[model samples]
Target: MPNWVDGHPAESLSIKDRGLAYGDGLFETIAVRAGRPPLLEYHMARLAEGCQRLGIPLDLQLMRTELLAFSAGLGEGVAKLMITRGEGLRGYAPPPVALPRRILQSSPFPVYPQVNGVEGVQLFPCVTRLAEQPLLAGLKHLNRLEQVLARNEWQGSEFAEGLMRDQSGRVIEGVFSNLFIVHEGALITADLSRCGVAGVMRAALLDSARAQGLKVEVRDIPFEDFLQADEVFLCNSLFGVWPVRSVTGHHWPVGPLTRKLQAIARDLLDI
Candidate 1:
């Protein structure tokens, strides 16, 4: 049982909601620590940017207050805030005047795996490839059938995360996280300009690494190139950074670079 709305009853979700019908909405999963989200501003910025791109009227002040108040006093948790085009009249056409609908829920932080969010994690290269949609590229939208299919490929018991490719078979990223590999002391990640979610942690690392004078490249990644990398790690808003111990039976070391990155990540988390 959780608060679906800030002050509304549970039945607030209409059967006619577009988000439920066509997944015409967006969501942000925030990591909370000590009654506060670590990167609240960055999360909000990504949310606002998604809303603006989707033509959804976003009451930034209202959203900020509702979610913040709801998340307060929860030392460790996850907050998912979503907005959908409310109650459309059975069609793809935008409503003359859209009434936005929302869902906000908080849950105790998930007990990530023993190796996950800790020592390191394994990855399974998924057969499911994300479709090319420039309009939706880099936005964390509600349409996640791709991720659903990818996640179902193999239970994370054998592998911590699934690696997804783009339509052209270019290594895109992990199903629910951003991908980064350290090669010759330089960090390389996929160029999300075409597809994949532009993760907040990914953005921060890009900025932080640049500030630290580390070379960061946003380029297309081939499977062979990725497998041959010196070091690799995956990141999300919640799991700050998790080094890849292996990928599809190929062993990888939790290198010195990954440890250095993890040190910064520890400061960004509840630990």
Candidate 2:
């Protein structure tokens, strides 16, 4: 698969790009199926919000066109779209007139153990806590060192994901995915107004749960409260859903609600 920079095939980026210097940009990891992104609108919506918040002038229509063409050519794979605030001088202040650079890259779909999606998996407890940044809370920005550190907390196949919390110790999400819990028949997830990435699959599942008449709540979850959940699950765009069977010393069975939502996610990803 060829990499595209500003809509042309390229393998290199400018040395002074703001995205490399100050992480001044946003990105989207999309799952392409049969020449198209299944959740493109969701990804674009997030990108638009990120661009607006960061004051990056993005050509959404042109990006949509390029993404469609690139994904069509690749046929099947993960499409990574990165928009950076173009090259800058030796300072923190952004350019008075910004010219955003669009980079599109493709990689083969990831392969995970089949048991992970079926029998469920364990979650590693990460000591790395997410800082509360309301301004950049839900945006999939370029700064991801926190997640990098948290992901390295555990090694080996024993743990499929790591559970992350906010600085205040509120259960936030997974290292690379969103966290959801079923409690007393209510489907609850963390309030991303303070931190954590609002994953595309998480959004879709929330809507699906509501449509299926399940009670939904989006609020800050205490660590103790999260541990008492009837069932827990994690989700991301690349890998639909994985039922979290255990984290730390607590354990949860793959309940009916989790299985139902997992099926919904599988259908959404067409896996």
Count of clashes, each model: 0, 0
* Per-candidate local distance difference test: 0.83, 0.93
Off by over 4 Å in 2: none
Q: How far is candidate 2 from the true structure (C-alpha RMSD, Å)?
A: 0.8
Q: Per-candidate TM vs. native?
A: 0.94, 0.98
Candidate 2 C-alpha lDDT tens digits along 1-271: 8799999999999989999999999999999999999998899898999999999999999999999999999899999999999998889899999999999999999999989888888999899999999999999999999999998888999999999999989999999999999999999999999999999999999989999899999999999889999999999998898999998778999999889998898898888
The C-alpha local distance difference test score for the whole of candidate 1 amounts to 0.83
Give each prediction's root-mean-square deviation over alpha carbons. Answer: 1.7, 0.8
Candidate 1: which stretches are off by over 4 Å? 6-12
Quote the lDDT for 89 in model 2: 83
